[model samples]
Target: VLEEIGIIFRDDAEALALWKEAGADVKGERVHFPKGLCRSLLKTAPSIYTQHARNPDRSVQIGGNATVFAPVYGPPFVRDLDGNRRYATIEDFQNFVKLAYMAPSIHHSGGTVCEPVDVPVNKRHLDMIYAHIRYSDKPFMGSVTAPERAEDTVAMAKLVFGDDFVENNTVLTSLINANSPMVFDETMLGALKVYSRHNQACIVTPFILAGAMSPVTVAGTLTQVLAEVLAGASFTQLIRPGAPVLFGTFASSISMQSGAPTFGTPEPSLVSYGAAQLARRLGLPFRTGGSLCASKIPDAQAAYESANTLNSTILAGTNFVLHSAGWLEGGLASCYEKFMMDIDQLGMQQKFCEGVDLSENGQAMDAIRQVGPGSHYLGCDHTQANFQTAFYRSNIADNNSYEQWLAEGEKTAPQRANELARRWLESYEAPHLDPAIDEALKEFIAKKKGSMPDAFT
Candidate 1:
């Protein structure tokens, strides 16, 4: 397919040149790879690698058996505690970052948790990157809207981790979505080049809304997914051999009648499952799945859909899970209630990923023996010892008696989640950053912002 149709590297002369140098048949912007070109280029990609956090204890290992959960990315609007959907602000972005940091199950501080439209288009990336560095010490993603913004992210990362450390380690794992239908635009390619050259990780994903971006069939979508990822991931190797890259697939089934993207559908889950297997076959880390949904609010529809998608992602052996929490309105808005709700579900998924515990304590033979004939185990010695940490307790669930629930205002799940989000924000504290590094980052941001006229567009 690659040889016949060829992938177009639009408006990028350097990318075309690199493909030409690598012996690919470069025809203008349309470059057709030799049959084994992509696969052979993927040989240098690592199967697994560590994305080091500023707090080394928070570092995550991507690929293999590991699965990392990050918050929603690239949302322009947000649903607040008042349940009103509005344009997201810088404050909202920081709050979400703080929530991710506070939530034990959310492994990485996500990029562009919500686009702060109030901030200028050119300058928002600076604030967004700073928020991740300040509010959270978890490994986070870099900007991919532009190559210079991506370069800025690398520079700021250098401030925190030092030049040598930033150069040597994979601190940022940014998202680079393919334009789909076998196309790689200059904007994404430029960012990919900057990140790849610096040895940072890039998730080369095909952002496909099936029936719209690619063929409707799951198999056809998967084929397009593989072709796009191979082209994108392989191109990273051409830029800098062994630069960490994940075979990222974001394939969603669209509503046939309305032509809107639908989430938690069976077909997209199958695509995710198949794509993970394909990534494994190529010896590259797989990235897909999230608590995705099309609902505008965090309701039953959202819950059901997110569960199906998130479950399929974990079961499919996805290494890095983006949008694992806080997605709503088909990625149009980041709902606060949904964020907390998804965090609770993420905790459950984390426990599920541990698999069934088979150790003595996990088996609980003593508890079984103490409560023979299934009389009771609640008051038993083993049960008493393990009660606190025994099961995955949900913060959003109301398991109390009906009367007690009424006394507590008969709050719905969204209500409970709203309260939890409020509590988290109220008690939140920014992670400690070195004063010198913080100052350097501020100066750099100020200088950059001053250099460019605010480009709201």
Candidate 2:
């Protein structure tokens, strides 16, 4: 339906021309980016604001790392918003998101989830993301993986939390049931059921990589995406349809040249757009953005790729735009610089989305009449009173003269971002968990571990 509407992965010559017109540096499947691509693309994005409140504190939030999203500098095992306690770090350029929040992502090593949480806390640079309840602008989503094997899921669970966390959090096995495909074993089914019983908010996904897991063409990718969504939804519905599950649409467009995962290439972006449409069809939220692949530091490439994918997806309205912060290398390694830059990018989005208020009489228009068009709105009363309320800010946004910028130290966005992250870390104090309850929770995990000594090994 979305395709018929002419607003999804457009890969034909015509589409290529369109992307190029949007300032994309297209080379076949690759999309080289130009500055301001995201801001520009968002103008065409097909989503509408869901809601708003008059109160400043009222907000909508979405998508995060269950572990790596945590604050690293806080006291060990700080409880996050989702009720999971874990680590957070700032010293490393790569941050550990909160536990289980980010769909299981591939590490640069092609092994290990994003965090090293299972390892001792002191040595691990783990991070946990805490989320207070809120709505989010990103409405489409794509979950990362849908492994059928029981052992793989059990292993995955252990890596995030200990053996006990599974029972305590009720994050059932990611594996499928015994009556189902052998690919999905009984253990996985049991675990998923357990998670469902608790009504966990998760996006189940059976990942299909083109030229690797599925076919290389768009049709093959679509078929695989459909199958994954079917499997995920089927399982969720049976387990608990009201579990706030989203359709899985995160697919990687593999590099035919290096067989490496491509980032911000038209291939992956296309795949993401495709996934978004499908999820919309299911009327389910999709989780599909964590795309930051340029190796360049807070340079042009990073901005271009991140902004293009972000603006495109936002325009497309993927339910849970993730990796909103701290990501790099095709969404493999988390980069603080990239995360910082993306925050600025989001701020810019906020600026763009400040819906126009066409109130007639006394104010905006009256002020306009008072100033008479181009005489300069900069020095007017209406302008001074509301300029700060109307502008987005960025250190790297090129808003000042070179000489004035030099006078202000000409700092890059990353510098300001790093300082911000550091400041946040320093000023932050972990939310207090009931000490005795926390201890008992730890003891419960220990006892569960004791029940199966062999499970640890």
Candidate 3:
């Protein structure tokens, strides 16, 4: 089956050279991940430690799509008319994941906010989106940017919101600090001042764009990405032995002709590949968002790009995938229709990768006997048993005739998605918090003076 298909690997000479210049560990095809990260990963085992954040994990595989999903879904606003928007419960997330990653980037300063999902089409909203995210049972994946400066770290840390600003100081202290190379010495001190606060699973990520930041080749990018991961590991090790963290790399590239960074380009694909390798070397969870290719809708472009990224990263073993839905144009904006389409696609790939079994004693002979040498197996029980499980079966992805599709109103993916979101909201119920616990949580949030989402009502 592997021989049935072909793959191409473009060699970027410039990117490779710069990474070597940075004193990265390089081999012919794979780079020896940083030593610091490997040590930490061994200590942490199942957690993300980062000999090289992108390497595939040895014990178990993990992957990511670093999300900017916290922002609003409908008509955008820094703050809504009613103040805060409320989402029913983390049921949607909790049911789907064993753990979910959350990170607030300095990028959020530019109006990148914790946007709420107004599914109930509600009357009230929640004020801070991150707080609701914090209320979840899943762990937080906070990130810090250390670009040689501490102040830069401080600003990034400030994004984590708590009921009261004072109580949440640990939000910044644990996750944000002098933990990454992204923070040039220009702001290291300011970052550490806050780092002394707590101990949570916070990750330091690298946004190494292939030509823009690192050199422009896959090999070079791999080594360069390794060094960046090393820098992050240095911070974690200095703080404690087994610091819970993940390796992050968003190494996109610039379209030589367009002059704009092409996250949807082959560069991002290469980065995904390299990050996975790095994760394996470290024996820890790795990070890099995937499944975003189209500029507008969930068309063919999105499908191919997302599949390529997932294929590479899953092999690499990244932890906590993000940007799982609603993205367009390198994540600049999101389309609801495309998001649902992508979800369907995700289900399909998962089925395809199930891989065929060659082992004996399973019924290969029986299956053949059932159908006979020249007979069709279309109506066989074997076919019926496994048929429905193939790929993501869906109402939106009807393979029915044009007449049948039209009978369903020929509704596009977006329409289907809107209805699905509506259905999810209607079916969702608020999580049951102990009455006293609920009061405490409410009291905590009540002190914060700001807008509250009308949906909460």
* Per-prediction tally of clashes: 0, 45, 66
Evaluate residue 416 in candidate 3 and report its C-alpha lDDT on the 0 to 100 scale: 72
Instruction: State the local distance difference test value for candidate 2.
Output: 0.43
RMSD, candidate 1, Å: 1.0
lDDT of each residue in 346-429, candidate 3, tens digit only = 455444545676665235566677899788878877777667663356645658899988998997655676565445444644
Cα lDDT tens digits, model 2, 1-457, are: 1111111211335434555665556665333445444333323212211111112122123222111111111122222222233443332312232211221121111112244344433222111111110111111111112322222333333443356644343332121212111122333334454445444444445455567766788776776665545443444544454544545455556778888765566666777778778766555656665535544355677777777666766666655544554455554445544554565566566455545665653248757777995697788778877777666656435577999879988887666666655554455443333455345444544554455333212
Q: Write the number of the candidate with greater TM-score, choosing between 1 and 3.
A: 1
Which window of ten consecutive residues has the lowest lDDT sum in model 3? 1-10
lDDT of each: 0.94, 0.43, 0.42
Clashes of 1: 0
Query: Which segments of model 2 are wrong by more than 4 Å?
Result: 1-113, 117-191, 294-296, 360-363, 395-398, 407-410, 432-457
Per-candidate RMSD, Å: 1.0, 14.5, 12.2
For model 1 the local lDDT of residue 272 reads 92
**64 Cα displacement, candidate 2 (Å):** 19
| TM match of model 2 to true structure | 0.61
TM-score of each: 0.98, 0.61, 0.61
